[model samples]
Target chain A: MNLRRLIVIGIPFTWLLLFFLVPFAIVIKISLSDPAIAIPPYSPTLELSGGWAGLKAFFSQLDFENFTFLTLDPLYYTAYLSSLKIATISTLLTLGVAFPMAYGMARAPEEWRATLMMLVILPFWTSFLIRVYSWMGILGKEGFLNMILLWLGIIDEPLTILNTNTAVYIGIVYTYLPFMILPIYSTLEKLDLSLIEAAEDLGCTRTSAFWLVTVPLSVPGVVAGCFLVFIPALGEFVIPSLLGGSDTLMIGKVLWEEFFSNRDWPVASAVAVILLAILIIPIILFQRNQQKQLEGDQ
Target chain B: MKKLSWFNLTTLTLGFAFLYIPMIVLIVYSFNGGRLVTVWAGFSTKWYGTLFHNEAFLDAAWVTIRVAVATATLATILGTLAGYVLVRGGRFWGRTLFSGMAYAPLVMPDVILGLSLLLLFKVMFGSMGMTTIILAHTTFAMCYVSVVVSSRLLSFDKSLEEAASDLGATPFDTFMSVTLPIIFPAVLSGWLLAFTLSLDDLVIASFVTGPGATTLPIKIYSAVRLGVSPEINALSTIMIGIVTVGVLTASLINKRKVVQRLKDEKTAN
Candidate 1:
């Protein structure tokens, strides 16, 4: 029985150790190496020499230069700061839009909740790139939104909504709305309505009761929703590249350019390592919240 | 359910409009007789024909479908094992690390994940290809699959397995007959989720793809970056149609199952 259990657990544990954990270790190792002009773009970690000399050469090659370079460069600093700014703003915007929709869905007739939930997730089921691509048609100079505004004489000229920070905000909020809504909706769905009703019966106005009762109860959902949106949006590459202007300097875009455009693999690795370090706190908090929720349920 | 208020109605209408108007516009213009995606010069389906005739696009689509299927299958098996361990392993050594790995990828930034995997592949294999892309996709997709399956396992009844073991069934036999059947639906849904995620991925695939291994999203992303056109719109419309049908069908089946369960309980009572 003991052997059987060991085998059952060993397979997945080993797979994750190799594929998941080892790859991350490689990223850290590569981040410590020097950038090179050759194929693979970073100085080789292993020397071709056999035995102790090769081991010595590998250890000698690793350094802190890439990380030091990132610290000295204003562009990298700006990218990191701007990414946090964009992610924070976008997370708030998504919450603002999603909270009402989720509240409505939770408060809807019980028979209709499933269909409503499905509708919220329906957009998510389609191709993410396609959904973002569709926005180009709607937000461009000659796009649908501009054309409608022009036809109505609302503006003398088309708004340059595409390829701008505004566009990035719109894209992030749109792509991540479901993430924000689903969590909040799950919490709201399980609320005992009588608590709100009881508050109202005690002469608390509906609005105040909502603020005092419902909002406090739903804090966990709000936090989870924000983390879900903020974490991914912080490193979002496709949306900013497709919709953002030249001025948009998100760290994800900067990392992509470093790796692909500039061929600076070492620098990209350093950027990734730094980004992951920044996120570790939120990641730990998110995990703790999940563990707490699981224990609460059990 | 509370009575629907004006606030609820307005929120629903406006929120859904914000969510869907762009796709609606894109689908409408896919049939535009004009070259511009936004301009309607009466309706035409020439772009659909053009999309079908594009050899590169077709090749990418084929590669994407194959990768998605492979990813879904492998991720399902690995993730099911991980999920089982998470809920049932009962204080095994290194269990915290196991659970953390299973859940971390759920929120880990895609760029970091992609870059880390790319570095790993370069060191190990010296090149990127479809195999590398499959490996990356399965790594993350399995995380999602694990979440789905583990949640289902959390609510699973332990007594059923105990009963089977009491009746002289071996552990494996009890799992095969009792636990597997009960969790099969969650596993199936996990496969579907993994498949869709694999199909939808672009950033990771771009980071890891080699020559001739371009996936559909990579192709569409590059094309859209340069400029927008109706052929891409037509392709998007077709994909949207397929996804819509798939989601609606799945939900309908799920609804029917729920209804059947309710009826069964009523009859038993």
Candidate 2:
């Protein structure tokens, strides 16, 4: 490459290497080191004696004790499995709500589509903490939902919703709805309506045409949306901590408590590393899908 | 008339209601005279008034603004360069890896990203505060900015730059005079995105922040955990109002540009 090209690529490459890639390596290193009562709460891997020999000693001291401890602790296993289950359920719930809205927006009059799109994304622009926080008033015992239900005579007593898995579901689905909607809407908006029309003109009904033509074409968008929601939801700390009951044992919260409350940095690092390893599968899949889409466009 | 079908209308209405009602209640109750967020005795702006005087809230807000501005500007610059390079620098070494790094943070869990970055900072810098927070925010925010700018870059017209170069302008000159101006709007949007993200961040900020570097989100989180307060509702309402105005203005500007372009095409035709 020429000088200009070299400068252009080198900045981001080096920045990401130092900030993103190196940090992940540090996480793995910290995961292997034993927890200490030191300020950082982890044993120093590199006791800088001199140069190369110091590095060799540091490498030699690394152990898999944290990883083994994670397996030995039943709480870790429960947290991981519960997080996975909650993430999966929330992803499905988000998709269910987002799909119809996206479809409606995609099928709206051309003149209104831009405004509709803006409206969908407008909520996302606000503080996510605030958005989740708002649910407190709406889902609490004396909150609006219960008040409305009581007034409507739907229930005799206010059903407890806050600090429950249901609340977490509501929060997750509510917060992530836009992530699901935007991608699917973009794909659906670009869809060849003529294909659906052609199917309709044949013996197929409109619903069948939708299922056969639109659904199949929107799979990439659906996949992208699911991954977007699932990956973050898997390690979500805010929603579950804020909205979930004590029984909602998510790995993200567990990891946070392990580090901050228990002062177990190695265990936290191990949890994060394991989480990253699990998420890598979906990340790679999403990247490959995006690459395919890009090639298709080209 | 191309109107929504009943099913479509129901879907839109319910979905929108679901999205907005909680926010609307929060906003509405922020003005409640009563202390309770749920019970509205009458309209009052007490919470908003109190928010202005709260020293902790004010300090966090100031810190947040500083971090947001710093992160937004730096991220936009770095992200623009990265995006331009990704699009224009053809088949360079480690290009694929660079692209992956740029996009990976989008889906990487905040917990993992925050933990890893915190570990890096503790080992390298040995202290955490405003600088570490800015670095962490910029790291993630730049990825978002790059995504925004690169999408714009994908549709960029290379002919304009080529024509500028053909007229004796250098590559840098062509970029500055021709390419940058054309893509300035995208860069601006990217900056706004980065700023908003920096403002919205809590988990990552919590991990990296030191004693005096608490942000608005972190403060709000701690306060909310104590229990829902009308002050938080008022604060949230103010934030929501600011964001709404910002988004609407941006959308209006973009819409006007689209209309102007369409009118130009019509007149030309």
Candidate 3:
């Protein structure tokens, strides 16, 4: 029994320790270390052969220079702020688009609900890169939207939608819509239909009952869905990089450019540390919400 | 029978249409004869032919499949074990930390994960390549698999395992026979999810991949960054087709299994 227990728990536990947990520790250590011009990029590799003085030297050498650099750079600050704003707005947009559809799916005849759920999940199974890439053709100046508008005689010239923040918003909402919809749909599906009837029977109109009951009950789903969308979208690199223009400022892109474009490992690690710090609250809330949902499921 | 009010119908239609139209447009334009991507031209299968002949794209795709397969297998094993431990291993040391590590990667942004892994690999392995990419993919993908499998195990009928235990089967034997069969479907779904994630990864792969080890998504990303091309459209169309078929087939099999189980329960009762 002990042997079985060890193998079952120890294998995965060790793997996570080595890979997931250890990597973040390395990131933190590297973030404190200084950038180097040598191979492997970061410097002051701690040497134990020289004993206590070497350790002291290493500790003294470790500095927050990279983190201070981050504070000094307006670019990083702006990118962080913009990423938050973009994530917020896109999450709200996803909620608006997904809630009604989730409602529709939940209210549909029972037989159709399964199929509708599959429809939402289908895109999730497909390559996310391809889904995001699909919008390029449609949102381009001479793309389908413009072509249709011109054919309808709405305008003589095509509007420039690609290479803009607006395009990022569209891509985010489109991509993350499923995440928002599924949770809301699950909550709505479990909703007691008799509650609505009871509300209507007790001098409430359909609209009033919906507003008071359906919307309020779905709040848990909404909150869960928002965190689901907001967390990833805040740190999004692909959508903003592909769709947004030069003016677009997102911390994920900044971190990518810092590491790859500028080859500054320490700085990139510092940026990542900060990003993770900001994400901690939302992540904790999300964890709590999911736990609550799981307990409710039980 | 209650019919959907027009509001629900309109919203559902519009919602699905919004979700689907972009891909449909890409599929339609993949056959365009002209060099331009957006404009309509004479339909042609030439681009698809061109895609088949592209050696670079083909090599990247092969690499992607190999990485995906390896990542999926490793992730499924580890994830299933993690799920089992979480659901049935009883309280153990560091359970909270273990569960946190297991679930954190699901929401972790790819860039930070990619960056952190790159930093670690540079320190430990010194050279990032296919091996490192697989390791990185498995690290995160296993988290997703654990979530799926553990959720299934959460709802599992535990009395079956207890029955096996009471019948004088060892705990290990009971787990292997009684528990494994019941959780097989969730385990399979987790494997599929991990496989798809590895296949679709670009960001993490980009961070860990060395020269000559580029995956398909990275190749496609660079190509797309160069601007939209008909060849890419053709590639995407094929990818979309594969995913559609895979998902539909999986769902159908699942549906059949559910029906069969229901029938079996009726007979047993």
Candidate 4:
């Protein structure tokens, strides 16, 4: 029985290790190698005939240039900072919009809860790319919003809303709002009503009771939702590329250009490594929070 | 008691409006008779007819369906295995590492993941195509399926399996007959989730797809770059309709099952 269990689990474990883990290792390895035309570029070979130099040539090529370029270059820092700023703002906006919606859903009568939740998730059925494209029609200069605004006499000219930071922000929040709401809803559903009642009985106002009892307990969900939105937003390529104009320089766009346009695999891999490093802190914190929750339950 | 504030109602209305207005516009514009996508030229089904005749759209749809079905099936199988391990396996060597590796794809940026996979294929396999795209989709889709299945597995009872084993059934037979049936609902849900995600993917598909392997999302993306058209809206509406029907049907069936189970439980009691 134990052996059978081991075999069942071992299949997936081995599969992931070979494909997922090894591919990443290969990326890191190639990132450390020299950019050359060889079969496996920068791999040191003893034979000097095949443009292969000794180990010294390989080690010497692996210098601080990649790391230095990421820091000293103005473009990289700008992209990194802008990506962080956009992600943070969008995450906050999504929270603001989602919290009340989720709260309303949670407090809604049981019969209505599922229907409301379905409404929230229905948009997600469409392709994410198409949904992003739909925003283009709505936000374009000659599109629906401008047409409606002009008819209503709200504005004389179309607004330049399609290709701007504002547009990217809208796109991110729209795409990720369901992610924020679902986690928050799940957490809120399990919250103990007695705690809020206790606060009310102790002479606390409704707002104060919420601030003291409700919000604190739902921190795990809030953190998880924020991580979900923030992390993806940081690496968002499609939304920013389609909605953002020249002004919005995100890391994902830069990475894409580096790999596809420049064919700079080493530099691109270096950028990926740096991006992975940036993500590690939040990933660790989120994992720790999950572990703590599990252990607390135990 | 404080009166219900107008502020809550106004915000709620605005929120729902923000979510629905774009979709509503898309649906309305799809039926517009005008050559221009934005202008109202009265209602017609011309765009929907145009969509039917567009061979490229049809071909891309076929490719997407093929990829989604293949990815969903393979990912669900692998994910169920992984979920079973996480719930039933021992704390053996590299267990934490395995679990983390399985999940890493979910949080990793699509651009990074796609680029890395592309680079790996170039270095080792010497090509970028459907096979690579399927593999990449499976990596992340399996993670979602595993998470779903494992959550269900956590609440599963083990004594049934133990009893089957003690009653002279082989371990494989016990799992196939007893354990599989119990967790079949979760596995089915996982498959549906994978199918939806695979259909919805664009970023990874763009990076890894080759000359002839373009998916529907990729086709829409490239077309949108030129400009929006009524045909695109028609396609979007069709996709939305299909998915809506599927989700509603699934929920209805689940509700029926729940009612039936309740009745059975009452009768047993």
User: Once superposed on the true structure, which residue ranges of model 3 sit more than 4 Å away at CA?
Assistant: B261-269
Which segments of model 1 are wrong by more than 4 Å?
A48-50
- Pull out the clashing pairs in model 3: none
Q: lDDT per residue, candidate 2, B151-236, as tens digits?
A: 78788777888899989999899889988998899999999999999999999999999989999999999999977899999999
Error of 2 at B260 (Å): 2.1
Interface RMSD of each: 1.1, 1.0, 0.8, 2.7
For model 1, residues B1-269, the per-residue Cα lDDT tens digits are 45889999899999999998988888889989999666679989999999999999999999999999999999999999999999988997899999999999999988998999888888889988999999999999998999999999999889999999999999899989999999999999999999999999999999999998999999999899986889999999999999999999999999899999999999999
Interface RMS for model 4? 2.7
Candidate 1's docking class is: high
Q: What order do candidates take by DockQ, descending?
A: 2, 3, 1, 4
For candidate 1 chain A, the 10 contiguous residues with the lowest summed lDDT are: A41-50
DockQ of 4: 0.57
Q: Model 4 over residues A49-99: C-alpha lDDT tens digits? A: 535455556556565566677788899889988999999999999999988
How large an RMSD does model 4 have? 2.9
Chain A vs. native, model 1, TM-score:
0.96
- Superposed on all Cα atoms, model 2 deviates from the true structure by an RMSD in Å of 1.3
lDDT string for model 3 (B1-269, tens) is: 48898999999999999999999999989999999877678999999999999999999999999999999999999999998888887888899999889888889899999998887888788887899999999999998899889998999888998899999999889988988898898999999999999999989999999977999999999999967889999999999999999999988988998999999999999
lDDT against the true structure, per candidate, is 0.92, 0.92, 0.92, 0.83
True contacts kept of each: 0.84, 0.89, 0.77, 0.57
Clashing pairs in 1: none
